[model samples]
Target: MGIRLPFMVLHAKQILKSTSQNVHNRNKYNVPKGHVAVYVGELQKKRFVVPISYLNHPSFLDLLNHTQEEFGFNHSMGALTILCKEDAFITLTSQLSAS
Candidate 1:
């Protein structure tokens, strides 16, 4: 019975470590399956996970076009960053949702 103490302790530690990793990974990309993550905001970039369907929206496509025309195809910044005010982005998405 005394010999099982160390094994139980090690098992507990492994569980804790694995749980921590899972949490970190989940938060690292809150974007769910079938959705895409986009970075927006001007002064401070913020990440937003949006549906792939947004690509078909003309207004959204226009933004992508402008970004391409200005920044070129290579964002190289890890995530696609949309240059715009946070408030404006919120309004646009809200309107999109309404439509």
Candidate 2:
């Protein structure tokens, strides 16, 4: 019983470590403190990090609504993507920054 307890403890530790490491790796991009990375552009796609606050903005919500309709929340890129012109995205983010 004593030997089994130690083995189980070691196995649980390994599982916890692996789980945390995977989470760290998965969140390495497209997510940061108070920001979200969104893939933008029509042809040549580019990534942009915007404040999470922008998510509350109507303009940003419009983009998200469009993304939902176009991609249906399951993007092949495995990340949230905004299907729009890069310039339009820039313009929207800039507006949020000004406020």
Candidate 3:
């Protein structure tokens, strides 16, 4: 069975995808074709290029929810900025990739 995502989740995903594409098209960032760039950290943010497929994962969606609460969709960064510790974000993505 397929998982159903909330409207907010889908909205966030679309925004992120659009922003990523724009950045790539402008030749401002070097994100690969099927990946997106996300800035993760609390104080000093670090950038991570992850597969766009991660957006479909429940855990990643939860992170997106937190990001929305903290930074909202219109962050000035012009990219998806996830308000989280870099290590924790890395661990979650690592686990997701491993599975």
Candidate 4:
């Protein structure tokens, strides 16, 4: 498990790099596209996957800004269920406790 964790981290790093490059290239060419990049084992819950362009999207950015203003930090994958408005607090609390 320990060795696998390192390998997963390395693979996730490579995936993130590739995704960033792809986003950069698409932006340079003015392409209307987005990429879902996954970081496996980056957190304890298996993987962290999100749209690369979503980070810059107006709605998501607004939410992120609001979260930062309210919580003093950006929402993280580990804290998504905790911070997201749609998530049920009771369920999330139980899940978190189990973990």
lDDT of 4 by residue, 7-90 (tens): 433443454455456655447434233444322221233333354444444444444444444553322532231134333323
- Per-model TM against the reference: 0.64, 0.66, 0.76, 0.33
Can you write out model 1's per-residue Cα lDDT over 19-82, one digit (the tens) per residue?
3456664687665665566678766888876776665566766666665556643344355567
Name the better of 1 and 4 by TM-score.
1
Query: How many steric overlaps are in each model, in order?
Result: 0, 0, 0, 0
Model 3 gets an lDDT of 0.76
Best by TM-score: 3
Candidate 3 regions exceeding 4 Å error are: 1-26
Model 3 per-residue lDDT tens digits across residues 1-99: 133346545775676667755745448667777787888888887889999898878898888777776667676666678888898999999999999
- What value does the lDDT take at residue 92 in candidate 1? 74
Instruction: Give Cα-based local distance difference scores for all models.
Output: 0.60, 0.62, 0.76, 0.39
Distance from true position, residue 29, model 1, in Å?
1.1
Which scores higher on lDDT, 2 or 4?
2
lDDT of candidate 2 at residue 26, scale 0 to 100: 50
Residue 27 accuracy (lDDT) in model 3: 81
